[model samples]
Target: MRNNVQPSNLSPDPRADLMVALSTDQREHWQHAYGAHPHMYGDQPSAPALHAVEVFRAAGARDVLELGAGQGRDSLYFAQRGFTVQATDFSDVGLEQLRDRAAAEGLNTLRTMVVDVRDPLPQADASVDAVFAHMLLCMALSTNEIHALVSEIRRVLRPGGTFIYTVRHTGDPHYGVGIAHRDDIFEHDGFAAHFFYRYLVVELAEGWHLRDIRAFEEGELPRRLWRVTQSLTG
Candidate 1:
C-alpha cells in the first residue's frame, strides 16, 4: 500500500512472455514458498484488509470469514479489532504460522483452517457475518470455479453480509504475458493468476448488491487490481 511502490506502467519482466507450461501444481508452489519464506507477505494487513475493517464495522459485522488468509495478517487484525475470525488457506504451513502468532498473542477470537476455495465452505447456511479475500479470487481458479466459490460465499454469509475481495485485472502488465491456461489465467514464474475483465466482475455480482469496484495497485510489480465490495440483500 506504499504510495511509492512501482507505478502503474512499470516495465514488464523480460521473461514474462515465455510460453512454458506451469508444470508444478500451484499448491506445491505455495507450500514451498511458505516453507522458504515464512511471513513472506509480512505482518501488516493489506490495504484491502484495512478498508474491510471499517466496512465490516459499519455493517455491524461481529464474525468474519477470511478466505486465502495466508499467515493471518488480516485475520489477526480483525480479531484484534474484536471480531471473531475464521482464517483459512489451502496451505497448512501458512496457517500453522498464523496459528502460532495468534496463540502467542492470545488472540482467542481468531481461528485457522485449511480450506480450498474450489470446494464448498464448511460453514452452515447463513452463518457468517462477513467475508474477506484479498487477491484470492484471482488465483489459478478457472471461471467456473470462481463462480462456484462466490456461490459458496453467498451460502455461508448471513443476510445483509458484506463480501470484499480484490483481483488482478486485465490491465496488469503480466496479464497476457505468460503461459496461458484456460480462461484468462496466465502463469508468471511459478504462480498462476486469473486476470479479471470488468465484465466478469459484473457477472459475479449478479445476485448481490454490487456496491463498489475501486482500482488499486499493490506489490513491486504494482499489480493493477480491482477492490470489489458487494453485499447480500437481507
Candidate 2:
C-alpha cells in the first residue's frame, strides 16, 4: 500500500437522490463492518480471483487494477502471482487494513486506492493491462451508473486488456426480498445489491468481445453470481 493514496468522498448527485443516499449508507456500512470485523472475508482470494489469475496470465497481463477490493485478499493474491496490482475500494477502513497487510508482507507490487466506482476512474486512458472486480458490479449502483462504470473500465484498459468481474445475479435468493430501490436494487442487512439480469450483462458487453458468463455461487446465502470475462481487440 502506498502512503499517498487519498480517500474519495461521495459527492451528492442531483439526478438520482435515492442512489446517492443508498451509496452513502453503503459506504458507511462497509467502513463500520470492516472496522468491527477485520479480515471478514478472510485472507484467501475469492474463487473468481483465483480464476482471474489464470485468465490474466494467459492473456500476458502484468499490471492489474482491482475494484471493490475489500481487505485486499484478492489483490494480495494477485501480487503474490507477480501481477502489479492497484487495489481500490470506497471504504478507507478496509483499504487501511489492506495497506497494513501489504506492508507487513513486503509486497511492493501491491498498492491501495480509495475510489467510488460511480465517478470516473482516476487512471489514465489505457493505463492497465487487466481489470478485475469480484462481486463489485452488483453493488447499489443504478443501471446507468453501472453502464458508466463499465465505460470507465473500458477507458482504463489497454487494447487487448482482459476485464473480469463477478456480480450477484437476479437468481440470488436475496434478490427481491429486501427493501427495494429502483432499478432492481434491494437492501438486505444494510448492504444494497443491484442484482443483474442476463440482458444487462449482454448490453454492457455490446462492443467488447465477451468471452464468458459462468454462473456460480458464494457464501452461506449461496449468493448466485455470474463471472463475466471480456477483452478488447489488440
Candidate 3:
C-alpha cells in the first residue's frame, strides 16, 4: 500500500451508486468492463471492499487475509496500516497488475498469490486473525459454490477469527445493472453473470460466530452501490 493512501472522506460516484441501489444491469456492465480491461474493474477500489478495512480496523484486527483481493486495494490499505496482509485472487493478469501496483506503491506488507477461493487457501489451519471478501464470492460461483467456499473459510480461520464481507443483493432493480431476481443474475460483457444480495450464517462451518451485519444501497449517483456487510468473530 502507498504510505500516502489515506482513508479519505472522498465523495462517491453516482453511476456506482445507482448500480448498487438499483443494479439489475450490473452483470452486463461488469462483463463488458472485464472484457475491455481484464486487469481491473473501474480502475478503483470497490465501494464495499473499501469499507471492509474499516470494519476490521475498528474491530482491532492485526493480521488479515483478503480473499479475491483483485486490485490489492483492501490488502494494501490494511498493510499500510501495519497489518500483515495476505492478498489472494485468481486472475493471473489481475494479480500481475496488483503486484506491479504494489511494487510501485512500495507496499510489501501485502503478500499476494493467485488462487481460487473455491479451493483451500495456502495457509495453516486456524492461523488467520480475520478474513475478508468484498463483493467477490457471488460474482465467482453459484450458491452451492458459496457453501464450499464458506467451508474453506472455516478451515483457515482461527477458532475465533473474524470474517467480514459485502455481497450483491438479490432482486434490486433500480441500479440498472442486470436481471433482478432471486439468484441475482445478470448479463455482462457478453458473458452471463449471476449473483444476489445474499448472506450465509455458518458458524461451526466457517469457524466463527456471526458478529454483525449491515447492508448499503446506492443512495444516489455520487454514492451508488448496495453493500451487504457483516463481521464474524470468535
Candidate 4:
C-alpha cells in the first residue's frame, strides 16, 4: 500500500444549520425524481460499476453488496454476470423498480433491501466478498457520518475483501455552484451533495489499503468523479 499522498486540512463547514441530517424531505426528493421518469439513471451500468465488475472478477469475488443501488442497473448487471448481489437503497420506489426488473429478468441471485447508508448497515460482519457504492458517499452526509459508514463497510467486508466506490470530486464543475451548506457541501434545487477531494479520499481509507484512485467524466452533466478502490489489510 502506498502512502505517498499528503493529507490536507479541508474540514466540513462549521455552520450548525448546515450540519442537518438527510431528512425525509430529501428522501422524498429522490423518490419523486425517480418516480418522474420510467428510468431516472437509465438502464446501463455506470462506468465505475462496470469497472468494479472487472475488478471483482479479477479478484475472484462472488458475493457482492451494493449500496445506494438505485433502480438496480449495476446490481442486475452483476447478477447477470453470476455474482450474488445484495442491492440496497433508501428509496422504496427505486427498490421496487429494481425488484420488478430483476424478477422480469429472472435474476434470482439478486436481492433488494431498503437501507439508509447513514445508519448501520444490516449485514453480518466479515460476510461479503466485496462491497460497491457509486456516488452514494457524496450524498447529504456529515464528515463524521461518512467515517461511521466507512467503519461499517470495513466491518461487514470479509478479511482481504475489496470496497469500490465512486464520488464527485472537488474538481467537478458543479462543486460550488449551489447554495453553500459548507466548504464542500452544496444544496442545489433541494438536492444536497458533499464533494470529495483526494485528501479526503485518503482520510476515508485510513484503515484500509488504498489500491487506486482513477478519474472519469460522464453523463449530460458531464460529472467528474474519482473511482476509489480499497482493500482490507488481512
Give the winner by lDDT.
2
- Give the TM-score of each candidate: 0.89, 0.93, 0.68, 0.91
Tens-place lDDT per residue, model 4, 40-61, is: 8889988888999999998889
User: Residue 39 in candidate 2 has what lDDT?
Assistant: 76
lDDT of 3 by residue, 70-174 (tens): 666667667777888888876555666677877888887778887765456778888887788876665635445566677777778775566776654444443
lDDT tens digits by residue: candidate 2, 17-41? 8788889999999999999999799
Superposition TM-score, candidate 2 onto the true structure: 0.93
Q: Judged by TM-score, which candidate is best?
A: 2
TM-score of 3: 0.68
Q: Clash totals for all models, in order?
A: 0, 0, 35, 0
Error of 3 at 156 (Å): 0.8
User: For candidate 3, which ten residues in a row score worst on lDDT?
Assistant: 1-10
- Give the C-alpha lDDT of model 1: 0.88
**Model 2 residue 71 CA deviation in Å:** 0.6
Give each model's whole-structure lDDT: 0.88, 0.91, 0.59, 0.86
Tens-digit lDDT string for candidate 1 (1-234): 213232222243343323122323787899899989988999898999999999999999999999999888999999999999999999999999999999999999998888887679998999999999999999987666688899999999999999999999988999988788756789889899999888788888989999999999999988999999999998
